[model samples]
Target: MDPKVLDQAAERAGIIPEYIDAWGQRKVISTETKRQLLNAMAGVADDLALAAALPPVWVVREGESAVLSVALSEPADWVLTEETGRQHAGYLSGGRLALPAGLPAGYHRLALRRELRHWSCQVIIAPPRCYEPAALLAGHKLWGATIQLYTLRSQRNWGVGDFGDLALMIEGTAKNGGAFVGLNPIHALYPALPGWASPYSPSSRRWLNIIYIDVGALDDFQQSSAAQQWWCLPETQGTLSALRDGDLVDYAGVMALKLSGLTLAFRHFITRGPEDPQRRSFEAFVREGGESLRFQSTFDALHRHLTLAGHPTEGWQQWPEPFRQVDSDEVREFRLKHHQDIRFFSYLQWLAARQFDDCFQLSRRLNMPIGLYRDLAVGVSAGGMETWSDRTLYRLEVSVGAPPDRLGPQGQNWSLPPQDPNVLFARAYEPFITMLRANMRHCGALRIDHVMSLLRLWWVPLAGSPQQGAYVRYPVDDLLAVLALESHRQQCMVIGEDLGTVPQEITAKLQAAGIYSYKVLFFERKDPAQYRAPDEYVPQAMATLTTHDLATLRGFWQLEDLRLGNRLHLYADDAIYQRLLADRQKARQALLDALHAWKCVPAKLGKNAERVVMSPILNRGAHRYLALSQSALLGLQPEDWLDMALPVNVPGTTDQYPNWRRKLVREVAEIFDDQGITRLLREVDRLRNKSADGQNSSPRPE
Candidate 1:
């Protein structure tokens, strides 16, 4: 291919020709790789003819009063229709058309006609920035507990943590003056194939994960004879007990138990008269869910059907052509044949949504300030429902990942497809808006994972190594505008996960948009011996000592992560491992010194101590230290409070480590009942209040 043609293709496809690496080195994408990515973007076709025949999608700010330019071969009459169906007609003169400022802020359709030659495009009007809650901007220091919802073990739940556990946890936290409960992404995962249980690798971000539904919380569950009989069985009870007692979550077993009970409940509900009030509510839910819900339910039922018929269910791409396309006549016929099964999945969604809403209501009743904070993953899995339902929006040939850095020298491929920016713009960003709104529902705050993706993403071709990838730019202004609009509409504070290989400009942009930054204590220390002063931390940030991806406070103190990494063969060599160990030792000693200086830990605990062990004193001290920060939001992990040694997830490895299945050392009841844990939380609450009142002492950096 000609270099000029490739350059033009890259420009049109929004592929960045060069980017600054993590080490601040500028690197150029290979010519061949650029060509491949552009081809994967479907931009190599006869674009000249298509471009000449069609008008490109246009975007304007809500109050910009902008004019749109169209390359017209002849004068044409234009008709513009707002999303509300209000239409405006005007005659196109020359090639430019002026738009009225009175147009509402939404997606509007623009149609051009001249001598029967018709063309149409989408015009998006977006707000300037995301919504900023008044409480967040009021300079209040609020504290919350972040937990992997599945790790929450409760007596009432069958095996996995459910909405009931969340409700109970909220009550406990609120009693101790907590403001919110942070959770991992609760996006929809595969119910039929329960073994595929990575929360981040979800089937659909626009729906709830049905596995979190508490069967007993369903309206007719207790009244149903079938459900009661199943729950009363000795074998079923034994299975639930075993799952709850296990160290790792048994996703398949738990899902089986829950599904059996849910099926019975569904049967019992359907037996009710058609005009029952409960039945009407369910129908309304389905109607409101509309096509997205229908597609997800159809995909779930079809996958199960295919699997039962001895066909592979890993991905729809491997299915026969007719069954692959979601809109195909064959797929529609199959859905009709298995309509009952599809509705079963839809019912599960309704139950999950209802249960989650109950938790939100309970939070409100408890008077928790922020209520619940939900996480939003960056992208969906490659063979997931979203990809199958809308193939045109994603570039399946390339994977989204991070380039080689200090953490992973070989680079990291998340095995998730990146959205095609061009296609996303062409669709008027309805999918993006829908996803934002879905996640923000029934939540006070939304945490966006890898928020930098809104501006650009590293697209690694599947056939090449991650190091050979290129950064692809997106319509950042448009996306941010939509996010602001959704945030305002939902009244949810937005927290952007702006860590790792992020540009400084991105941080500035996020800060200006009233989005909170995520700051981990481990990354805040400038040197091994000295942490950043508490007063130096950003005021508009969520501060934490560790994250799910890193070692807990106990693990960090014991250096268990290094040992685990060595056993898992994550280090490049023994030398690198030894270097990391030495660094950890220094950092540990520095932390001990800081704790002594701050009087967080007992001053008698030697400042010169060579090593710190996992103890209640040290764990509580860590929490207190982070609570003293100037950050407006403080998040504490229950695993750290319980002194759990294992990290929830180990980056750069999949099968080698139980990534997301580790259960918390203590159950929900035990955690709430532990006096020591309660005392520590109270101390955190006190310190947070002191900070909010501006009565805390200035940080004494050691």
Candidate 2:
């Protein structure tokens, strides 16, 4: 193929032929890779020829004039219908029509007619910016607690944190004057195969994870004889106790126990008949869930059945060819044959939804401003239900990853496929819309992980190394418009995780769109010796002392993560490991110095605080330092309060460090009861309130 033709095809398919790296270095994509990607996208003998023959969809900003270009064999008339059902008629003069600029902001349909032939396309008119909540811009500083929900342990929970635990957390935080309770992504994961436990790598982002549902909290559980018998079983009780006592989450064991209890509850519910209120409610949920729900439930049932039959259940691709596609006849037949199994999965979802809804309602009743703030993962797992159901919208031949940077010297391959930008636009962005709506349903705020994905994603070919990846562009304006629309409709504040290799333009755009930026204290410092002053932090951001991916406050001070990394052989060599250790020590010393200078540390620490060892004073001082930041929202992790050393996640290594499996040192019941924890929280609340008042009183220039 000619190089020009290949380049044109790649451009049409939204593939970047060349781009700048994170290190400000220009990188070019190989022609062979471009050809392979284009071929994978469109199964055409000549992509350039095919691109010339196809008509392009029109995407125009609202209040802008547009010209429609048509390939008409004869003189034709065109009809335009706005989203509000308003229709306009016009004639195509020589295959071109001048469109007026006053159309409403929405997805409008355009139909072209010439003799007996007809063609149509969707025209999207998007708003200028995302929705901004009045309260977020009111110049008030709010504080919240971020938790890894699975690690939350309560006496009543079935080993792992549940919706019941979330309610308790809300109560505790609200009592301490917290405005919100932040959570890790609670997206759906496989229940049958519990070993795949990364919340960020979910099966589907649109649904709830059943593992978070408190099966014992169900109303019918206490009434049903089967449920009571299962709950009271000696072996079941023993297993639950063991799970609660374990240092790490026993995903497989806990899920197995919960499934057994859920099965009993389902059997009892079914016996109650369709006229029962609860049964009717479940049916209503299924009806509202529509095809998305049905498809996910079908996939779950099939996956379980296959696993039970001792067959591979990694992904839908491994299934028989006839059953691979969601719309296939074999899948339809399978659904009919396994209707009860599918219903059971649907029932689980309904249960999860109800419990989650209860948490939000309880928070609202407590008068929390931002009740529950949920997280949105960057992408779903490659072998998950989302890919299986919507294969065309994703490019499975390549994975989404980050190029080599300071943090990841060898680069990072997340093993998740990139969404095909062309397919997303061709489908009128319904998938993205659906996902946002589903996730924003009962949350007051939504944190978009790796929010840069809206503008671009680093794409690494499956057969290539992460270093060989190139950046691919996305429709930023359209995506942001849809995001703003959903944020407004859901009455939720948006927070973008714009960390690591982010362009200044992206941050400027996000600020203009009213999305809050995420700022971590560790990254705010220019060097180990100097930290960004509290007043220098952005007011439209959520400031935190640490994130799940980084070392906790205690871990950082003690160099626990570094030692563990070395033990796991995560470092490239002994020199690199030693260099990282030295850097960590310097950072720790600088942090102590900053804390002392800010007067956050106790008087006993004195001027030589850097020489002092890790202690409760240093931990609390670090939290206090972060709480004094000018950022509008401050989030503190429970692990930091308890002085825990383990990190929740370690990037680049999956199984080496027991990622996402560590439980909190203290149980949910004991966390708030500790006098030290309560005192620290009160101090944080006082500082944040004082800062807000000070800001409000200070006059600003007109």
Candidate 3:
């Protein structure tokens, strides 16, 4: 390693040489790298300084006064204080200003504005906390399910699955054995563009993207003359017809129709909807959103400015001056001018919520135990909605990823920027708690994706590759406490996707807190099996034959599963594949032996036993809540082959892969009604019952 490179990188990361020796051994930085490091650090420091010097904002009690302090670059002649808050004297030696006494609070905004230097942020003085979440979920049960939204559709929806479709699905699932219907995130996308689909990589997480709303189902749409005229159009009629026939989802077409309808509805709302309860509810949502809403509104306006100017809003760094700074007067004025656009975005959220609520209500009506098990992704994109709006809460310079393991030789670098837990706790975990509340609103249970993130995340510097990230610890107790409290309050069951090389402590902690962990059948070893047996599965966890990321049961059986190993050429030599195949054969044999041992299989059972047995995958997993994906039930080897031809995700690649854009081959509505699929569900149900009764079955408790 080059010493000069090491020094340069160290300087860039703001590490003293001594600190470098202590922390950066074996890592080298070139002299040329040092110059780039200096430049980047300078930019980072500039951004940090602006963020830190903003305001003395505090969240306090309504009756209490809030004390404030400021660490500034220079001294000010006069201190600025709002009427509601108290101002104090006695400047510290370092030109820091401290408020001597606290002032009564409601909503307080304190700023230091001395001739062209101004900074401000709204602060809330909260009421005493009466809502502790743990007590809520301790004895509560939930009922819910989640699938790709486009998979299901009703006779009344557009080409893509809409609110109407979801409501129907929820009702149907509840009527069956399920209680809730969880959905992929329906957050808003950049409006100007329609087809850049992937709900996970949304333009905004806080706001609902309007495309999912069912225009024809809305009460307001029926009352509107414009909607009636639009509905009469041949194209509109054709679209509806195609949707009922289970056509592929044309996201662009759906978005176009929805936007036009919503715009018209907004006009109607502003002009004639004077005493409507729905109108009032929309206003209430806006008020409750507060500064967070303001930030989104501001971003929408700025994004439009850049878009109209023929620039990609995605490339904000390349934008000209006055456009780059989020707080510039130009951006502020743009917000004031384009307030309608912001309100439009807000309106979309209201509509989505209304639809989501209907789905939840339908599930409750069906009396399902757990409703809507929503999945929360492990992390957010680097500069996406969460990162942009909650910048202070995240460390953009550090990326989260997985360490190299048997599966991934070079490890995994998920380019999501992780939250600065320190900043999160300081703000009392408002971001995390809010996200949970939002999800819980229409969910019966919550599935935390990559649940291990609650413990620690590997952080890589922005300039570094996937392999260079460092492991950083988080306050796991506080994180789990918040989750427990929120989940209990929501009366939702929590399931953690505890796959991969998860630290052992995480599983213990989760189990202790009553959070269910995930168990997959594909990873089980049955020959002198290290994998748990059916009776050995923890009664509280969710048992599954496969996950969205892993191959379906059929694919696993055929040795065609896609994973990081295959994608990264880690298994190019075929040695690993051969071993895996051999292991698979052994596992299959073990399952047959166990079943025969239990007297479930007849002595006449032949070589075809492997092909006939579903008990091994369904009965032999270590979780109580057994979930089989539709693909597995259908014997579909590759989910992508069921419709589109691509894996939902290929782990380590971004541009070289399509992460989450595959549309299911079979429309969701069709699948539910399909005779073949229905039979499979019944068969799986039969096997599950047999296994539960301690009949002839394989080991493991799926």
Candidate 4:
């Protein structure tokens, strides 16, 4: 092969020379062979070159032939485009498509119809126009206390907490002199399979999870005949009473009873019919969702088929020839037979949306500047509903993940096939815009899981180790523009999870764009006393003591716990880990000394866990907005929070751990009402009030 051509191919693939040599060395191929290889990768080559050609863009030129490619085993049904205006049916793999010939030379618009799986870019088939400043969506700040919704058990609740629980929690927080109530991601997940639950790994970013719907709390439920006849089962009733007194979330038991009630409620909804207001709203939501409803239905049908057919379902690549590709007629017939199931799926989404809107309304009622802060995951699974449904826009052979960083030694493999960057730009970036719009709906703020992905993604080839990945860039300008536009439309603020090895330049870009970056107290302690002081924390940021993924405050202080982590298969530098251990011990001792100085602890109690733990040196990393997780505030280990042996999410595992399960201990209500926690909360509130009024100012320790 011509070295230069190979070099071009490698560069387009984002492959470094060392890797190329490692993978390709000793392989023999002639110049003719090189030409064929380029042809084979022609579509991909063009996309890579175009994506690398400029920063992420939205405008392409008319009359130019921009090859459209699909990211799947094969192409999709061509007829699918007519129904949805999504071209997912046509190019599941790389192929050239001439841009509609000749158009007015300014910005024109088009839409792709594959719901979340489609991407399109723009073609400028004309002379370059003057640059214009991009507009963005405006969002508000929400500073409030948070308790997981499912953590609360109330008289009205089933076995677990629900939206009503959240409303009550927010009300209580407000009564206690708090402003807001934050919670975990509440995105929709597939409901066909009963307990496949995790709020973060959502089935659809476009909808809410029905699992959170307050079935018994609904007005209709009150009017139901079933309520009049209800004599609860002793065991179930006892469980509910227990939850009503608990302090943490019980996801397993909650899901079981919630699902049972929701199933009944869904039936009731259909049987009773919609009220005038509900009918109008349903019509409106349907109109807005349009083809998204259809695609969702179709995906639901496919999902059911896979479930029934059993595991692996003949990997898309290995399926029978006709059904193997997305565009095949067999797939079209499959959709026809499964149309009802698909429609039910769409109905489920509408139901979830209605409840989600109710939650948002509750937030607004409480005067929260931002309510229902929604979270967006980094990407979807490769062979999941999204990839199967919108096969046209993905690169099935490559996956998205992180490069080697402090979080993971071998980097990380997320297994989510990313959109073809070139196709996204050429098609007007419809997929991204649509997804943003969907997430922004009824949200006070949106938390982007991996904000850095807007700039670039670490692309790993299929079956390749994360260490062998390369950085594939995205059009940051256009991506940010879309985010800004959506945020403005939603009237919500954007909070980027800009933790981890975010490139230094990205923070400035996010700031300039008015997007807030996360600042966790634990990570900020990298320099101990030099970190942002409590008084110096940025108001623009949502300050937190720790995140769900990291060690809670008390967990961080546990020397034995830290050592246990080191012993785990998780990667960490031995030297750095030991140094950190020593530093932590010294800090703990300093805190103990400070407690002695303050006389808050008797000399004997100075060595006590609680007293020694409260010293200034131990509080060295407290920020302006101290977001203490319940677990951290209680000084319980992470396991205590989950009421389990290990953390709910092991950062770098799939099969090794139940990463998204492990519920919290007790109910959300009990957490607030517990005498100890309530007292601490009051003290914290007092400190916060003093800080706000400028009366709590203390000189810098240095």
The 10-residue segment of model 4 with minimum total lDDT is 629-638
Query: What is the clash tally of candidate 3?
Result: 31
Question: How do the residues 1-702 of candidate 1 rate in per-residue lDDT, one tens digit apiece?
Answer: 789988877877778898877787888889988987987988723353266434456777677877877788588998999999999999997888888668877778889888978888887776666666566667779999999999999878877888889988898889888999999999999877888878888999999999899888776789898788888999989998999888888998998899888889988888878799878878999999999999999988898788778885767877778998888999989988999999999998888888898899888888888899999999999887899999888899999998888888888899899888877766667788899989999999999999999899999999999999888998887788778778878888899998887877688778877788999988887787787767778998999999999998878888899999999998889999999999888888777777777777886566664644677888878788888889999999999888889998998788999888998878788998999989999989999988888877435645
Kindly indicate the candidate among 1 and 4 with the higher TM-score. 1
Span of 10 residues, lowest total lDDT, candidate 1: 44-53
Q: How does candidate 1 fare on TM-score?
A: 0.94
Prediction 2 global C-alpha lDDT: 0.84
User: TM-scores across all candidates?
Assistant: 0.94, 0.93, 0.72, 0.72
Best by lDDT: 1
Candidate 1 clashes: the total is: 1
Model 4, 518: alpha-carbon shift in Å? 1.0
Candidate 3 lDDT for residue 452: 81
Give the per-residue lDDT of model 3 (tens digit) for 119-191.
Answer: 5544544333222224123422222344666655555666777777777666545443443465666666656
Order by lDDT, highest first: 1, 2, 3, 4
Give one clash count per candidate, in the order shown: 1, 0, 31, 43
What is the TM-score of candidate 2? Answer: 0.93
The per-model lDDT (C-alpha) reads 0.85, 0.84, 0.57, 0.55
Over 4 Å off, model 4: 6-142, 146-161, 193-198, 219-260, 272-277, 305-340, 526-531, 560-568, 571-580, 586-647, 655-657, 675-679, 682-695
Stretches of candidate 2 exceeding 4 Å from the true structure? 43-80, 88-106, 112-117, 123-125, 695-702
Error of 3 at 487 (Å): 2.1
RMSD of 2: 3.1
